[model samples]
Target: MTTETVAQALLDAQVAWAINRLTGDELPELAAKAVDDVLAIAESTTMSSLADPELIKSIARTIAATVPPSTAASTLVEHSAEVVLSNPAGTYTLREVVDRDHVERITDEALGLTPLVEKVLDDLTHSPMTAAIASRFVGRIVNDVVAGNRAMAEKIPGVGSLVSFGTKAAGKAIGKTGEQFEAFFGDTAAKGAEFAMGRLNKIIIATLKDPATRDAVLEVFDLYADKPIGRLDKVLSLDDAKRIGGLGQDVVITAAASEPVLKLVDALIDGFFTVYGESPAAELLDELDITRDILVEYAVAGAPRVFAAAQESGELDRVVREQLSPFFSSSEVAAILEGR
Candidate 1:
């Protein structure tokens, strides 16, 4: 699925959210409803450019005239995941018997959201809140991809739906929606959240060991010499702010910020930018090698804590406030609160 696919799903779910809030248990039924509505909308969208506003308005009028609101017209969302993953008897093939090699491929897709999540964390200039929110957003997105991939990957002996129904049906049912879902089910972080996590986690560990993904992550860490600005100085972009608001910051940040060793290198970029302004970019480039070593130390020893001399009378505020405080305090804690 592309951006459109996800966006449409999100839209349908939002509408479902409004409805499901009426009764908590209505979520699955509402999800089923949302899935049906989405399919119908998808069907209508195929013959028209519903992607365009004018076309959507035109279709809206046509629908208003031709289709009256009712049980069918009120609409429900349908998920092909259930239909695809299940055999005619409706048993899940993945749990019953998984193809080890194909399983490996699906695993890669699930863990693939990390770098993207880490990048958002590293780039947001002044927003701990946003960084956190983006982490959770990317987590769900990646999880969905895992579900889709797993649903498609598991071959139940004779079925041929490309994406398996049993897999995604199970994945979505595990409560991967929002804060309540995450709180109750533990989402992606929990090792036993779902069968998908088992496969997804194995792939993540494998990706960590893979020379390519590992090197890429390490390379990002190598760039961690940039200083970080204070909370107000955080230079959050409009897009990032919107996305962060769209998702909860704490959940996103907690999950996303857990990038094994990559978080350190990524932090260095923020820590350094906070320390030195853009004017030092050239000088920083010169010390790139040293920076890489320091970043590695950051990964190993963690962000450095400024000493009493650095923070006592606010020495950090004097010359290094933006650069090192809050990140690693004199007490050796630097996970400062960011954002306004």
Candidate 2:
């Protein structure tokens, strides 16, 4: 045969061999060997060398920019809601989803953020608006009490006139005193409000730190765990779901494009790299609980379906031939064939 004919024959034979190996009982062995080879390569390669930070950031930006249609978002939300509503609440109980130890750990971690909480409370309590609100709240309570007293006094026999006159005098005096106090000692009143707020903060912090707080959380979880999940569509109409989905998508798009969020994404990537950059890819996979056996198992399980689909679409032979033809048709191969 001519050199080209021999090359074609060799390519055909190789493709046939590959297809047989991939589709036959030897598939599992082939998959295992492939995984082993990959693992061997991964054992020497660092994660940092494989991942390009700029490329990842570019991909994120591209995804953020490509906003799906509102209808698509709505459909996604509808499907997700349907899936969620189909399952009973008992399908995922607190114990099944997370252990008590995890809950305790999370609670402890939250408690460790007391300084951030304190700063937020300090800002809220010390605001001028807070003092004004406190003053209004106190005034409302006083008015309510006075109104109650007046109503009780009116219900009594022959004491209504006397009590009404006394109450009016007391109310006028109280109002005048309040006005005078506000006019002269506004700063002192604000300080008092701030002091009350500080006390309130202490109470809140103490409540959060209490062991009962954890118990209360657990109790709430216990109460919810057994309850059946309600049909979300009953409460949230399709229109509402669509609107919320659109709004959420818009928010995500905006946030993803924002400088702060982009910086945060970069920071997270950098943090991951800082921790795992020098680690071998195989070690990283091991750390992630993905063993070689797991990889091989998944590959063997998934490859058949994928290969079947490709074969059905008539792409398998084309792809195989495309890959093997290059080697078979190379100058060195042709020269060797000519010599033969």
Candidate 3:
């Protein structure tokens, strides 16, 4: 027959075979047999395979070495760097990435805008470490106050003015100007200051011992909790962003390229190859239950979907055309067609 006639005859036979066999009752039985054969072969192979410990160990070692932690970390870093370089948004400033409102809220929460501060203070003061530190501080302050009172009692009229002047000068030198000290002592410094110091010392001791003092301290902290010290908007500029981004890139690149890191990479590569090369891969595969079962199950479950997709897209026709088109002109295929 001519080439065109042969092609036409093959096409006619294909259509007939598809209609007869594909639509027949034998299809389900064929499918069932295929599944059973696959399962049986898998069970026999897998059971024999996993019985070898060395194979299991070797495969485990190979897999472990193939994806060493250092290598994985380096790969991740490289990928991250590449992504950052490619994306315009990656060049965002610290200010852009940082939510000032969220930060302010966090600051407020941490500083105890509400009862949070009191709870934190209560926890800290109640803890042995904080209590011990506070106790030591209180003891030192009490000692100094007591000593000062005694000194004042001995030389109340004489050196009081000198002490006051010297104290004010020291405070001024430190840029404090004694405002806080003045506020604490008030006019009491002029009116029986020694009596005031003794009472203040007693008050300090009482405050340390009192539970209400924790709440009082927290309440005081809350006053400054959400108060903006400076403009958050002007915190980071474009120049600052560029500088920071460049510096970060330099740090990451430098760390990755360091001699220690290179040595680590070499060591990891060498160790992995050595371990994997000497491993019992097949025996390891035997012990592990990673069989064709999962694939088979997926195939069985997804058969209807596969069929629907193939029917919808004519994928089966395309595949058959692609694979069997050349074979149609072959003598063996011609003989097979004649027999059919």
Candidate 4:
């Protein structure tokens, strides 16, 4: 009731906690129950010792450090950033877990520690294990702690959550059956994708608030628009990759991004010449609008035909004149044998 009594009660409470921990029962019940009890004690006294903001944080740090982390639930709850934000112990313990997990462990325990959580989520969402699980059980979990935080991400402000989701997805996806993968897409099979388009959409729409992102998002949608409608079809169709080969493009591009796209682009470029003959090359050249500055980049990118076109169009000389002419003496065009 009184300040001294409340302070003494808080001290006693903390002592009891430390004693319980030290005696080695590792009282799961006591530890778990303490989470609620401590909050209650703080609320009851209006400003008990445990209620001291500074003290509360300090105790939290201690408890988290002292707690066991081998279990999945512990990793999910106590070692995560969401918990760390609740008190000092959580913050310190989570930071420590993150540091340790980084050097070697893969840090699965500290799944959601930093603003970087988004990036981790994105990576893990594609992780075969997480994806396998999410592909199977995502309807139950993907939407809130999974999907909802996508909206809350900017508020958290970083790439961590997205990366985490992706890592989880990929890891889970590996072991999963086709049924599992289909489930993750929630009937639409959105690339069987989790955070990429979602987070990207969240960001672009929030920033542009118009059809500005419409094209970008549509491009992503187009990727899977025809490939396979469900995970069952996608998995079953992988065999078609060897036969049809085009499916290989989808597999390579969607399974891994950017790098795979680079490979696909290279393959497509090679295939254009290999399969379609020089006709495709002519078609591509015609499709290119040499009139635009954009064409210059493709020209400079070292595509053989693009360079050839640049030379024929006289743009190579123009490009050199525009970009390199300054380096020359500029008095006159040097004749190859004139100097000799």
Candidate 5:
């Protein structure tokens, strides 16, 4: 046969061999060997050589820009909500998902932000809007109480007429003087409102700082932990889920595109590179607790199903032939076959 014919025959044989090896009983062994070879290479290669921080940042930007439409987000959320609502109430309890220690830790960490809470409370209490609201609220309560007392007094048998006359007269006199009195004591009212708000802030701060607060949280968690997650359709309708999901998606999309979020993404990527850039890829995998055996096991378990599908689609033969054909058709292979 001619050199070209010989090369073509060899290429066909090589492709067949490759397909047989991938599909035969020795497939698991091949997979294990391949994994071992990859890990061996990884042991010599650093993570930065594979993926740099800039690439990761670019990927983040791409993901942020490629956010799905709100309608799609809403549909997905609605479907997820339906699936969740259809599940049994006892599918998973809070206690099963999270331990008491984790709950306690989270609660303690949140409640430890006393300074932040105090600052927020101080801002609210000292605001003009809050003072005005408090003053109006107190005035409404006082007026309600007086009206209630007058109503009750008018129900009395003998003194009803006299009480009614005195109330009307008092109301008229107060109406004439009330505006002047308010003008005179406006500053005092504002101060009083501020004082009331300050008192409320103190109470709120005290309640948060109380040791019993933690216990109360724990008790509430305990009460909820054992209870099965009942149907949530009544609490959160599908329409509500859709609306919330769309809004959440929009918010995420907007935030992810914001300068601060982009900066944060870059910072995180840089931090990761700083920690792992120089380390061998194998060491990084080890740090993640992935071992050689686990890698082999996963490869072996997943290979058959993937190859089966590829073979069914005739893709395995096509890929094997495609990979081998280039080598056989090269000038080097032709020269060797021709005894050059």
Candidate 6:
């Protein structure tokens, strides 16, 4: 929280970033070479130059103890909220930050010829969970429709009404009996529920695996995939754009200082290092596709949408004129502008 500590943290982060770049080559051969080089150097390192584990632990503990979760969380949320809320040109500033020219380049690099949509489709289709869920949904709809018709018929005439009444009575009696049985059988209810769910899942999985169901799902995907981006032009048009932007901006401006936000902030800060430390960080990074190239590419590809959306909402002009223009304008220029 002191200037010195802040400076040191920045330097440490820079060193870590440097090390990551040095080791994380896209090519396997280059990565292997980098690992070998690190190993060779590490082999030659003296004990005196090596970091003390106990001392490192002690320092980590000291830093953690100093930064109380409640205070740290509150300070971070308050400061960030203040920066956005207190600024006269905050919305404009946000637009300017988003609209920079580097965004397209970033996007191009990140989105590099990956056949992203196709990959997504392939992944979804191959996922067991997706197949299982889809089958279950279809089964549930069929069952509901059939059951509804029967139930509706039971409520129609005199005999039907009597049958409906009897059905309800029977259901209540069965439920009561089941509860009593469960009470005597300890975890019988839980086991029964689990068994029922497992059987339902199996049926759903079978339905999903059916040729007709699978073909129908794929056909839907194919139809959608064939549609042009222009099909979405209306959704991203000015009226819709402003509504979306305004809603998001309103939520941020209004929600930042709330208790729920502070709780989230606290949880994130408190768990940050601990969560990642439990796993091999390198493996986690690889699994998550957190390579520098991928990250840089995603940022470039995605950054421009922020600006484009802001411009669509007429926020970009406000940012440039209100927030940026005055800095270079002298009193005479300001007066002339005022006169205009």
Best by TM-score: 5
RMSD of each candidate relative to the true structure: 35.5, 4.7, 16.9, 39.3, 4.4, 21.6
All candidates' TM-scores? 0.18, 0.73, 0.30, 0.15, 0.79, 0.27
Encode model 5's per-residue lDDT on 1-340: one tens digit a residue: 9998998898888888877888889899999999999999999999899887798999987776665444665577667767766664546778888899999999999899977998998898778779678657766877899889878887988777887888889989989787877889877767878887787678779999999999999999999999876667758877777677667777887898888988988899999999999999999899899999999999999998888889999999898888888899998998898895
Error of 5 at 261 (Å): 1.2
Better of 2 and 6 by lDDT: 2
Instruction: List, residue by residue over 1-340, the lDDT tens digit for candidate 2.
Output: 8999999999999999988887778887888888999999899999889888778877766665564434566577667655554554533444666676777688778877877897888788869788567546666877799889889988999988998899889879989998999899988888877876776677778887787887887677677765554566668776676667668767876787778977788788788888998989899898899998899999989888888788889899899999989999999998898887
Model 1, span 23-111: residue lDDT tens:
34443444455445644454334222323334444554444444433244223211222222222343233324444455456556645
Candidate 2 vs candidate 5: which has greater TM-score?
5
Greater-TM-score candidate between 3 and 5: 5
lDDT of 5 at 242: 65
Q: What residue runs in model 4 are displaced by over 4 Å at the alpha carbon?
A: 1-50, 71-214, 218-340
Question: What would the per-residue lDDT of candidate 4 be over residues 130-236, giving only the tens digit for each residue?
Answer: 55455445445555575566555635756767766785787577548556766665534544444444454355335444444444544554454444333333253
Candidate 1 regions with alpha-carbon error over 4 angstroms: 1-101, 109-114, 130-340
What order do candidates take by lDDT, descending? 5, 2, 3, 6, 4, 1
In model 2, the worst 10-residue window by lDDT is: 85-94
Q: Note the Cα lDDT for every prediction shown.
A: 0.44, 0.79, 0.54, 0.44, 0.84, 0.52
Model 6, 1-340: lDDT tens digits are 5444444454455544533443344334444455556445544553324444345545554444444334554455545444443443522322234433454455444444335533454455445556456546655876698578768887777667776677688779988997888679755644454444455555545554455664564455445553432323334554454455455545654455456755555565446544544444444455666665564555445545555576678765555445433432445544544455
**Per-residue error (Å), model 3, residue 139:** 22
Candidate 5 matches the true fold with a TM-score of: 0.79
Each candidate's clash count: 43, 0, 8, 66, 0, 6
TM-score, model 6 to reference = 0.27
Q: How accurate is candidate 1 locally (lDDT)?
A: 0.44
